[model samples]
Target: MDKPDLTRITTLLLDADGTLFPSEEPAFGASAAVTQAFADRFGLTGDFSAEHLRRTTTGKNFRTTAQDLLSRRGISVDSAELEMWVAREKEEVTSHLGEVLLPHPGVLAALRTLNRRYRLAVVSSSALTRLAACFTASGLDHLLPPADRFSAEDSLPVPTSKPDPAIYQSALARLGIEPQQAVALEDSATGVESAVSAGITTVGMVQFVPPGERGDRTAQLEQAGAVWVTESWDRLARDLADSTVVVRT
Candidate 1:
């Protein structure tokens, strides 16, 4: 992979779910709960595992992911019903917020260090409420406050989710930076696609990916256009510091 031209990146846009907040367990659990609820409601007999949830729903918006889940069970529903199911899933996930969400190791420190030199923002497919829950849980709420946060909820009347570039474009417009002047950190192929499509140099984060699947995951992110793939925030922090030196000289 080519070295990223970090010198031009004055702002950083981060993906929350797998990148900043690593508590994917609860997210998966919530999806499972909602899927099961639908299954029970429809009298379907198959089970949904966390792995299945992670694989299918990780980078998608709630509506899209939920629709995918329902489709897997040979069921189909209209927008209103899908929205209702999504609401239930959000409620179920919110109830277990504390147990399912936490910051990744070294992430807080990296954020603190990076915040000193670059503007930081969160761009997520997650709803604003759930994003707030994770940010509050991880104590990242203060660092990337509301003004600097953009969620699916903010992507109104446009392409409303990741892999669409609308959210990233909105964030860039708000931050007053060009896409070439920013770097995006993301953990899923879906997010990588979104960032890359938005014209930002993107780094694929793999710290939260299971050890056995990381290699394949790395390949996936690369295929989706991540310029770099890393498993350690500490290492990324150091690289950023080094990049600053290059920028100065």
Candidate 2:
């Protein structure tokens, strides 16, 4: 990939779950419970522990994760049943996030600095309700407008999730900006693939990741096409502000 032209960038597309805030522990805790319930209902076998779910489906929405997991087990449910489970998971996770979510360290300071220079929008694989809850809980709702938050699970006509690139494409179109005109901050390979596949320059954020896991996660994000990986929002903010580009292999 070529170096991104920072001068041409006009928008910052942010991923919500781990990138913008540290909600994975609580969010995945709720998700694992809901997923286990779904698995029990369908008689599907495999671990649905919180860590396992986070490892397997960190960047995927509940709807996609449910279908994928069930399909792997050769279990299929009717649309009504699937919708019911999806709704339940969304409600449980959103509620959990609303109560426990907080912005990643330095996220507020970074956003306060960057928001003034570029258009800020959330581009996430989460449902809009969940994203809304996250923003409100983390005190980020004031920085990014509701209309600017794009959810792959709720914003599109046919709900989808990352690594599909549909959400990033939709977000770019809605913002009326070319792919090169925006920089995407992601924390997972699935999200990096989505943004990169849509032709946007992607950066990986791993501040919320465990220290021991960050090296592996950083490599995964780079392999998925992130131009850079960072563990500090302040560093990212400074780099962007100074128009410094650092590509890590």
Candidate 3:
């Protein structure tokens, strides 16, 4: 992959979960319960481990992940039932947001350094409410702020989830910036695809990836067209500061 043209970039679009904030512990537990509920409802049999469910659903929006999970087990449910399941999962997860969600190590310092030199915005596949909750809990909301945050829920008339460029495109349009003027930091394959497809310079963040899985995760991000990958936000912050020398004319 080519080096990101940070010299020309004036804005940073960041992913929320797994990028800035660690995955919520409650959400992980809730997802396991929801997955088991589906298995019981469908009378399917297998080892439904939390890690297994997480791997299956990571990087996907709630409804999409639910559908995929059911489809993988050859279990079909009506739209209302699917909605009910998703709502249950969200309720359980969000209820414990305060106790479970926290910012990743060095993410706040990195954001502070980046915010000094470039316009910062959060572009997340999560719903706006969920994104707000996490940011508020982690105090990242003060830096990114509500006005600069974009979410899958913001894509209206037609829903555009990650792996689609619509959310990133909408963010750029709203921020009044060109794709070339922005750099995106993402942790998941879906998030990388969204930013790369939107014509932004994309960096894959692997700090949150489990130690054993970093190699595969890094390869996945590279395959998704990330221009660069790093496991250290502190290093990335310095690199960005060093590379962003060209002023926007």
Candidate 4:
């Protein structure tokens, strides 16, 4: 997990929900509807916005965010809640999830280009099933080829999820890679923290911009140790490509 490790980084760890697609809006509109249903089912009041879930979790990891969010609201839920919500609401909002979070343009090209040189892996803290559906729906799953996509369910009895570094570590281990030989792309504070802590190079993709100046996220992400931050998928590809060059040099 040192500088030399980065030079040989041939693994690319990716966050699915927010990073592969976009944030600020639901990947599947149904998620929002289902989320509201949960809020209502729990008798919780107010609109809970995790618009920047991806960008924020990039530092901490997704598990920490989910548990912390629940603890904050006194809501005793687990990662399973997300899966349940998706199963129940997906049918209703299938169009939204399928439509709203369209793949970032040129991302497939980036994936394809990098795939030739890097062993790409999807390391999400979300449920694997749900992510697989979204990826399939968006055609990203097809574009992803045979790369390994890791979620909370596959590793640990649920280590509180992301921002914990557990998923990243699991993905790397599963791929027989070392931390220093991997670079993770995250879109959330939680994710950033997790990857950095794991000693992997972390790049923050600011996929979600707070509504109407409600927050300053980029600065916080940078402070959280995000080595790179940008909105363009192309820039992200180029920045990461440079890492490969670093390795070869």
For TM-score, the strongest prediction is: 2
Q: Give all candidates' CA lDDT scores.
A: 0.79, 0.89, 0.78, 0.62
lDDT of 4 by residue, 136-203 (tens): 76567765643578776445665456667777777777788788778788777767887888888887
Q: How would you encode candidate 1's per-residue C-alpha lDDT over 82-183 as one tens digit per residue? A: 678878877677667755666654889988888888888899987777777888888887788988889864455542678878888888887788888888
Candidate 4 C-alpha error for residue 122, in Å: 0.5
| Candidate 4, position 188, lDDT | 72
Cα error, candidate 1, residue 87 (Å): 1.1
- For model 3, residues 1-249, the per-residue Cα lDDT tens digits are 558557778888999877787673355666677778777887867755667756655666676766666787787788788778767766666666656776654888888877778888889877777777788788787898889888875554565478878889999999899898899999888889989999998999988778888899899899998888988789889877778455533
Each prediction's TM-score against the native?
Answer: 0.89, 0.95, 0.88, 0.74
Better of 1 and 4 by lDDT: 1
lDDT of 2 by residue, 1-249 (tens): 454568778888999898888888788999999999898988888989999999888899899999998888788789999999999999999999998876554889899888878888999989888988889988888898799999999899999999999999999999898997889999999999999999999999998888899999999999999988988899888878777432311
lDDT of predicted model 3: 0.78
Residue 24 lDDT (model 3): 33
Q: Could you tell me which residue pairs clash in candidate 1?
A: none
- lDDT leaderboard ranking: 2, 1, 3, 4
